[model samples]
Target: MSEQVPQLQQDPQQILEHVFGYSAFRGPQQAVIDTLVSGRDALVLMPTGGGKSLCYQIPALARPGCGVVISPLIALMQDQVEALQAAGVRAAFLNSSLPFNEVQDIETALLHGELDLLYLAPERLLQPRTLELLTRIELSLFAIDEAHCVSQWGHDFRADYLHLNCLHEQFPRVPRIALTATADQRTRGEIAQRLDLEQAEHFVSSFDRPNIQYRIAQKNNPRRQLLQFLRDEQQDNAGIVYCLSRAKVENTAEWLCQQGFNALPYHAGLPAQMRAEHQRRFLREDGVIVVATIAFGMGIDKPDVRFVAHLDLPKSVEAYYQETGRAGRDGEASTALLLYGLEDVVKLGQMAAMSEGSEEHKRQERNRLNAMLGLCEITSCRRQALLRYFAEEQLEPCGNCDTCLEPPQTWDGTQAATKLLSCVYRTGQRFGASHVIDVLRGSENEKVLKFNHHQVSTYGIGRELSANEWKGVVRQLVVRGYLEVEGEFQGLRLTEACRPLLRGEESIELRKLPPKARGERGESRRDSVAADIDPADEPLWQALRGCRKQLADDNGVPPYVIFHDATLRGMVQAKPQTPDQLLAVSGVGDSKLERFGEAFLTVLRESQAAPVEE
Candidate 1:
């Protein structure tokens, strides 16, 4: 290395306060930083909005030489570097987004020991020249973001993540830290194994986001359901609506915009420019909703998102949790609304059958789908059911989910279920839900009549209930193990568990969706950012946000990079009078206080003098 910063005293607490503008480390952060600084590896499984970045960022500043971050995507790298640079940290990234000359400049900075941290895409970092040059430098430590990508079974598996084991092989002496917001025990073990951090200390933070209110409804009219939810419950909120297919994403986005919502579509099928532009708007603008497939939101850092709606079923519980976890990142009151039905299960099954993975892999995927179905159909606390899937639990019912807030009613569906099961049996179990529903509703549809099944005794018996109700019964049957999906036939079949109910030897109670639960429920608390400000400080909050927006626009980064809403909330709560007083705010790192502290103090002072409205 050409030269290094003069040796300076370093401690995690000192770095936390002076470099990051935080007074203390969040859960397990201090321990993680201490471990990495002492020349050891650490595996941290913190939830979203849990400050996982600081687990390594603080240590990167405290240690000598430069920290190397192996990020997954170019956009993520760019965002991180912009945020860090805004914080007055000398950070740079070498990615395809950078032009040739810019890449050369970043490389020079790394070699000359001028950068505090460097972000590299694994594919580029593993190249011969990049690896050789990195070997020539004096390195501090490595931080692997989105570490779950290393697991083959994960929703966002990346082939390049499989090659990260070389980090241990090449820089054997440099300490390392791997971080992910979503990972069950299995994924965690796989992450540690694949990254060659088997000897690292593992920290598992609780996988709960209490501020997010959970709700799920049967998908009778998904578009109308989502629009109604948006209009009634959480209008003017930035959110994400996830669909199962690219076509659905496009249709939903168009439909939403026609209804006067600022909606955008994001999927792999779209052109890269279009996707980037849409993501930029969703990140930088206020109250914009992006209707997307699961391909988006892997590395997003937006903290003020108010909702995440699912138009169709996700492939796995982990995928569902990770996607919904995207909302309420700032610990604000938010909503995760899902609308699912029999179609979701059938579609997921068909996709699994058509997938190219090994039979064992397909089987595991199918099991995961079934687990997601269980979560949707659960009559108890949605949060508890969700947490239990990840091997976590809550001591009591969480009042934040639909089931717990307005408990669902149950009815003896044994009779309705019997008719549905018998319809499947008498039809030779050769029909999917639509055909079966037609048969049950006594429709003389071509398929049902063509199959010579109109004479079946069970036909028309389910006509008492509407077509939608019958579909609900079938869905519940499938969830309760009374019926099973046959991949080869693309049809439903009666399971052994159906015999007891069919013979009247057993009773089954299916959940009845409470009408009250579907209606709007009052938020348990005000928005975290909005609640922190007094009525007198509301003007100041707006001024601070406006200042942040301007700075973010000038710097060409998201507003949160300048100062997160939490930081702004702290400023309003403390009402700091001077730059020195401003340093006491949670996110006011010394560099930030020096750069933007004076401007914020001016706003606070001006707000105090403004006349109050009667």
Candidate 2:
């Protein structure tokens, strides 16, 4: 049991300060906590790092019995439990990772009312034995984390989540809180309907992660672009690079390794043990990068990840938001770089069309993909567009995205669009962008001449524009729904939405292609995880990190579990030499102060006594 467990009747705010070491609630946390404490229900829609856990963790401590958390992230359950235990909360998780004897011991503890909180995988919790065991004990409340998985339309949907309403059916008297970081209005309704939380109060926090600079570039030699971004900006920082396929993940990881980086590959296709080891290294070590597909990063709680780069396009805005949200989780400045191209769009569109879903499902997915592409091509603020997709409105430009920092120039491409659409139509609309572009650029290539496209009326009519420029126009047309990709060859075809532009009834303003390489834009932004540190305090910072590493290694946990980088930064700024002063630092709760205060205080005192290196 953790030494810092407060009395059963302690105030929620007291638990927040004494156990978690925070002064106040962020956003709707306090209100949600109050709702749960009063034995009501809540449906929380906060952002990734908006302190969702405290809403239930604090309420559980204040209420009568133990709080049971149902999560789908089996890989992360142990780390979550360990972090809570380190904070002096009597937290334990029942998962396949534990031996039978340990599971029996934990069950014994729960039956004896010795645990304040318990974490369980949803599938495990649904078992007959687990249900019977739960009926034998008092439960403070039920918390459903990652509740968006209940919605089939959600990107990370899990079939097991469909039956979570059983919690509501079986434990009607227990207050329930279902929480998720990413869900639009439609997905939220689906979650409520699926989880039987229709009457639960909904708390929707702002989805803006202003600290993350959103940047998307035209994919030209993506590996080189990714390497440049790493070498120039995010050197020696913990980050994640997402690829669309397992092979790409592996190849990218190996290539990065050859380029002298600490990169590892993770995908569902990898051996389970290998994936687990890579995930462990990423969580436990510093300056390590994980090159993975979408299979990774659902419940990752690593706080210091500095960047998330996507070598290919995400399928939807929700997925893009969720994946990018993993970065800058500690509220420090971070970067989300995406290298995208027309081929990515074609591939994703074909995938959506060929999926096994019903027509309506496929249509919804196609619309979602188009919206994501719109976000990429838009000349306006990316943050505003992203928020707007989730039904949250941001009135002002964020000045943090690629467009806001170096706004792209827009040109009147209505004539150019008409010419390309005309070319596609004249070329039989059965050819892909490259062939259409060749016909437009007057290339007299073998394919064009063989197909007699050189004799078409619109052939060489668009000679004024370069091949790359024509490709951009085609991509924008496809993104705006004026065009669609179909068939095995991925040929371009016109949509009804293009009628106005084709008839010269509408003028289209297209973003001018940006420079081949965006230069030093991120350099001006103080986005590094350690950007707040002072040069003169370097020695103290190193000593604090060293102390944290040693403590974590001795305790067999990640270094952040000992003390987050934010807490160390707090320590450095406060320079606390006494227990009370150290406790004054944010994230330093009574339990952590008691366990770690002396060692850090000694370091502070010794730093004061050491002579200046200069």
Candidate 3:
């Protein structure tokens, strides 16, 4: 009801109520939204699902005419546009997915000032025709979604985003807001510069998703581990199971379905209709499991997904974080499960080395992959370790993950770590984890024999630990900074931190990884919102929305302009039986009350009240 803007440019609280139907804004949403609506640019580095969309979407609506949204993915644009439409915002999109006629229709609507927002892929926006059309439209502001794509080092980089600078060039008067769910300092600079927003404000939210439980499992019996995770931790919960290959995606989906879950496969290799069907099923049906490859997630908008299980290691931590954050969009608790092994690390490393990037880019990619590997092998509290990698400080352990819930046994691993480091040193630190492991086990393989690694004093010293256990120890050492893997030629090398352990100057505590426990079996609670509502209020709210939608259609406006969900909630509580009474509601201006209040109040009057206790 308050009309005053915080900081004189944005009223994020009001935007929260009016556009997003929420009573309050989440962390950093208010501040970032405030900066942008005040006619300034902002570089936002938030974790996925950290309400990044609301930062721009709400301000776009609150400001004025159509907001031009430049997004990276066509699929993402489509999903966002659908969500905005569902919430009764006059939103549309023009992308490769739309036919010429549909594009023309949207263009006409934009020219007529009928749309509040228009979403476009960066590639489409760069086209001369699209740019020309944008110049003629009543533009309120420019919003760049997934702005990190402009950075060459970013995981999802697209060359087209570099052209977004033209918006700033052409429309210097229009305030530009660039937003991304994932970005480090490097990517942030690229976003600001590439979008010509160096002078824009920067709003960096903490990179934290406290609601999502992070877990990593050794890939031994991964299928079984995944099944158990689903059965125990996520029984009858909506989730996505990601695989690296299409064949694996299909097989995993089939396996899950055979195990009596509502499983479906989705991959770029699938028939278009099949992919769409699986996506629809995942969205509409409760507790359906979508077994998919990386191609499936960029555009997904499902809010109540309970879990995201990775059957293989993700290419990088950024990609993993973004994919897993899809669960628990409603601010409820969720889980992100990763199943990985040394092979996964090697595969990812090899893939990174093969990508068509410059040497420096490849090196950074390897660093990111190594960080993911460290996460998989970390013995400390999973959340603390993950948050720390993102440069966040955490004082205590999160008591939700497998490591924290069932603490692993601690053993002094200083000697073993020293021995591992010695092997790397003696071998000239010129190999991968597997070769290091082979040398530690005193393998007489061709490579080991050719290098004469058996001559080292530390050779076969690790015979006391199993290959798997030794690997866990070595991985912990890497993650803990006792050792570092050199990116050039994928060398396993020791860092200065290793000096203390090797010299007995420090003792290293290692947790003996226990066998992963299976998740709860059988169907559990699925989105159990209270079925009961105030009987008088239910129909009235529905009727209000209905009337609003009808008015929106008649006037070529969005339903939210008539009444947002917050207003509807207020109406239900106030139970205003007449337009005059409705006009007394907090947000009701006389003009709006006169124009649209009577129809909603009529519906409110017709609704029956629930029986009240005396």
Candidate 4:
């Protein structure tokens, strides 16, 4: 049975402005907080950087007792606790990183109600000793972060999530909240069943990130292409380059460093300490590129990531969305550029086939892979394609994506498909796309002559199209299910879906690639991120950040925990002269006003910028 505690209610807005310093809640955060403080369960589906934490954190502070957050990652727990503490909330954590004595002290504090929010890993919460300790105290609520990890079909799954359902069985009256950044309909149902949140209020925020510009390009000299993209789009801004393998991550990092870019490598195979140091540097320093595998980023709290480039294909649309969502978290203009070719598709398929999972799970994984391919080959707005996958409908094309900016022209592809498919069949489907393309373009080299004297009628017949153009046709056909790259050889073979095309009964219209290279400036949307301060006050803004960074370094925490960019902008605009003047600015809570108020005010007085508006 759960221990009963006295009910205490506080105005959430008062807490929000006075403690956390937000002017108002974004989207459904207020409603979610209201429902939770009223002792009702809720399930929140918000995009990354969408203030999901505030929904639970505010309620935890407003209602009686303490909030118990079941977090999956140790780093995530630490980051969240540090941020809350900076916001003047009573937050702490009990994880393996702490000593036994420290754990005991936290447990004592929990029992005595000395804490407002206590974060514990799911594994720790399920332990017998921890369960006994919890039974001796009162809990405000049970909040689960990253709820999608409970889904067996999710990209990142943890077996221990299955045991989380016991929270309800143990404390039937305690309300629970499950929160996630990404989940499809099936995964949502799985989360509800696994965490006993079926009856909870469902709050699904918009999946669109308008600040992120979407771009997909064909692979042609990928190294050169990546360098061009970084220079043209990001211009030395901090970003991430995602690769599929550890060796490639290392090589890419080394290459980027040799080219004078501050770059580092991160993967599961690296030494744990080394990986930690690299991640720390990436977080602490400015304009450092971290070339990493998918293992590196899950709930990274950095808000200034300018771009996310993919040298290889992601396994599914969910994976792509979650990874790309990490960029431009500050609502600034960012870019998600993916460069893929035939090998990415073939290798990803082979890996999914060889993975150790149940047959049904594998089938589902293949379906997800196909969906990702569909997004890559979409002819309309890329944002629409992404949003539609999550059951969201956008009636009009978004003017932000590459398609809406530069629509791909359609061409009659029936003859090109006939030429490419015949080359594959004549070559015995024993080789991959590169070789098949070579034969199609009538490469009468020794290998072509050795393979069969180039006797096929399709040979030399495709000279009208460039090699790049023909490769495009082959890729589109493979994506459309008319051809499959199979066997250990990774050769192209015809599926039943290809019979009509081969029999000349089906006409094909394939999208033509953009003639020129696309970059951030080519988009139709205006530069949407405006400077929050006046041009005359830009130097003061830099000085304020310098002070914040100095204090953050002294305190051994991320700079954002001291004050977010938005808060600093507010300070610059307001030019507060005293503690009382600062309190009126948004994000200037009592605790922050006391800690950072004097240093910031000193900077403002030295600059002597304009007076506050209104």
lDDT of 1 by residue, 24-78 (tens): 7778888887788777899999899899988888888888888999999877887
Overall local distance difference test of candidate 2:
0.90
Better of 2 and 3 by lDDT: 2
Predicted structure 1: lDDT: 0.85
Please give, for residues 402-434, the per-residue lDDT of candidate 4 as tens digits. Answer: 888878789999988988887788778777877
Q: Candidate 2 residues 276-316, lDDT tens each?
A: 99999999998999999999999899988889999999999
lDDT of each: 0.85, 0.90, 0.75, 0.86
Worst 10 residues of 1 by lDDT: 1-10
Q: Tens digit of lDDT per residue, candidate 3, span 152-243?
A: 88767788887889987888777788887777666777788778888987887777777777777777688888876666556777889999
Which residue ranges in model 1 land beyond 4 Å of their true spot?
Answer: 1-9, 444-452, 487-489, 523-528
Q: How well does each candidate superpose onto the true structure, as a TM-score?
A: 0.95, 0.96, 0.76, 0.95
Which order, best to worst by TM-score? 2, 4, 1, 3
Clashing pairs in 3: 228-519, 231-520, 232-519, 232-520, 233-519, 233-520
The best candidate in terms of lDDT: 2
TM-score of 4: 0.95
Between candidates 1 and 3, name the one with more favorable lDDT.
Answer: 1
What does candidate 1 score on TM? 0.95
